[model samples]
Target chain A: MSTPKMNATGEKSPQTRAPLPSQVVKEDEPILVAAAKAGDISAFETLVSRYERKIFRLAQNITQNREDAEDVMQEAFLKAYEHLSGFQGNSRFYTWLVRIAVNQALMKLRKRRPNQVSIDEDVNTGNDLIPREIEDWGPSPEERYKQSELAGILNSTIADLDPPFRIVFQLRDIEELSTEETAEALGLSVPAVKSRLLRARLKLRQKLDRYFRRSENQ
Target chain B: MNCKTLVVELEDYLDEELDSELRTSIEVHLAKCKNCKLIVDTTKKTIQIFCNSEPAPLSEDTRHRLHDALVKKLGRPRA
Candidate 1:
């Protein structure tokens, strides 16, 4: 048998398929969340099966360490289960779960980087929002790379961003949190979330442009 | 709107939060400004790529440990 390959993100090569996750529960999340809150173990397991991969990725992106990421994901789920009764279903369960996970990931990140004072510094880059690269990447440029290569490009670029920008971007873009939700999750004002999101998007675009640019495609 | 202002409002434009008049102004600027247009398009693509990409699968061992830990910690929930 061929040994499993590893990538920059420490994900086992996509080829060494992990045992296919069991049927991802098709039920609406609120229903599952309700059941889990009611002590229905299988319902909670279904939620776990449905979200583990995304939660793991969110943690890995924030902590940038696989083991730390795993711990964060595990701890997040445990806490979510422990606090199930408090969840009022006011927002999406996933979003609420994401809030718990982000808090867990940030705690791990803060412990690892003691000198970094805060992830919500409200940076001001007056008149610095211009795009340096002016080239078009034709439609579906990501289709140009194989999945693993594309994943590598994304992971490495995001890992380079300072934690503040990276965390906002991860929640807003990758996880599809609303601007307000992202703000609430991180304890930042809505404006602060907007500011960081703009910088993060532009910076990520500049980084990804190297490989996806029209010139690079030629 | 000039490029700097356009850039500042880029997220709002992309997210379609701008009222129509402001949105049209940005759109007009995008039509006339190649650089701004590229920035908008590619920034959009960047979001789309990450948004659509599948999360990598968890290793089975990691999956098992997560489940085992939950069960142990939470105490298997009452049936």
Candidate 2:
């Protein structure tokens, strides 16, 4: 990856960047989509080959079960095939397909589990002239890099978060999705996504720092 | 605000989704309060790490089974 170049807001800008290749889909995408819509089996197979892996992974993440994920993926593809004519290309095919997969995965999850977490915590905005202080909850950058591998620390900490927090964490934090996008995907308000994301991050950070501290002593 | 009240609103502050007045207040307090500063810093880093994570891949067996089921359901010839 190229070093990030900052803009006026100090957020990274693309212009001060290396010329990376664009990630536009291959030129054949529209052709294949059209043919698939017309019952061209080969074209449909190509689309399946292209998107199956992504759809499967999304299902797996949501369901967190191999068998359930497999079922959801298969069902999503079949549903897409039947409704291919209705595929208006409003969004990328994969985005639409993933939505179907998410719905199916959540359906299966809801069926097997009757319990949903209660989100009773009121979003408290403090009376301070300035908002409440926000602090870092995780390890220092140096400690993070020096401790057990980042991957291991992340996995254990993520698993330790509350269930709803874990789900939001997985979808937004891990997925690198924007707040609005995550909110739309999960049917939550933007405020709700922000709240869960903060809580999830704080919990994980605490867990990671504690884990590394213990390991360092041992 | 005291630490108790600040802690409760910490979520909105981190997101920068709070109103301007609240945002400034929080920033001011964070600059002075070492404890709260540590929490915010750690929280931001934790999320950055989590969001930057590479997604795990599906196992080969699961992939194979999914493909087979799709082909059977569609009855399409293998490419």
Candidate 3:
């Protein structure tokens, strides 16, 4: 709650000047959170700027609408600011923020389609047959050069997944959140997150294998 | 572990969620089974490619609008 020290010129002291939000690293988050909780608006704004892109993309992935995602991002940040006092610091600030962003995005989706089923209810049972014929995608020096194209294909493939699987994959693999964090954010059980992630990864692997095999044939 | 069991558990194996005993069993099976080994290796590669891929960046306009909106809501910063 201590105020940042100011120099004779009325600018923040060099030691107290916060790093640019983009330059803020993980270890600095708790300090930022404490500052924000102490009514430092700039501190909270730094948190917003740090996670804005990631939250926007998560929203976009969930809502599948650019405008809706933008709206969700704004709303999520506002909600975070309002609830900043309640953040217990038990979880990482980003994880808490992600939970809020995810809830906002899902709420937007539900508002658009009131009859949608819960994502967890549609979970795959994890008993799907493994394709016996999956071709080996051994390391190839040339394939490393096609990363951009692979990313595109991977994006489209992820988009093709059912909502439950896609969200799980986006959070776990793409965003690289831990299984527990993803489960909490999605309001799913840990086992459910693991199952959905497995199915999503297997599906993506099958698709990529087919693509590589086709390219090899050509 | 047999191929069917190993196939079913491959994802867990790769995720490191399997207990050490089961993990060792899978490792043993993978060493002797070329097809299972191939599946595991390829699946690992698939995950690597996706994880290494970057998500799309937010546009400049969106970034600016977000910042401006926050600044307005939070009030102007004091020097």
Give me the candidate number with maximum TM-score.
1
| TM-score of predicted structure 3 | 0.82
TM-score of 1: 0.88
Q: Write the per-residue lDDT of candidate 3 for residues A5-118, one digit (tens) a residue.
A: 333322222221223333234677899999999998878887886788778878988887899999999889988998999999886787788888888888888898768747
Candidate 2 chain A lowest-lDDT run of ten: A15-24
User: Candidate 3 — which residues are off by over 4 angstroms?
Assistant: A1-25, A140-148, A213-218, B77-79
Q: What is the Cα root-mean-square deviation between model 1 and the actual structure? A: 9.3
At residue A185, what lDDT does model 1 achieve?
92
- For A7-108, candidate 2 gives per-residue lDDT tens digits of 332232222112122212456777888898887888888887776765665666666677887899889988988888999976456556766777787787
The C-alpha TM-scores of every prediction are 0.88, 0.65, 0.82
Which ten residues in a row are the worst by lDDT in model 1 chain A?
A10-19
* Candidate 3 lDDT by residue in tens digits, B15-64: 66677899999999989988777777766766666655555678988877
Interface RMSD of each: 10.8, 8.0, 10.4
Question: Which digits, one per residue and each the tens of the lDDT, describe model 2 over residues B1-79?
Answer: 6566676777656555467887788888878888777666666666555544444556788767766876786786447
lDDT for A129 in candidate 3 is: 44
- Give the local distance difference test score of model 3: 0.72
Q: Taking the tens digit of each residue's C-alpha lDDT, what string does model 1 give over A1-218?
A: 11213343222222212222331223477788888888788888888888999999999999999999999999999899889899997867888889999999999988998779378775764567796648889988989999999999999999998889999999887776778778889999877888888899889989999989989898
- Choose 1 or 3, whichever is better by lDDT: 1
| Error in Å for residue A151 of model 2 | 4.3
Question: Model 3: clashing residue pairs?
Answer: none
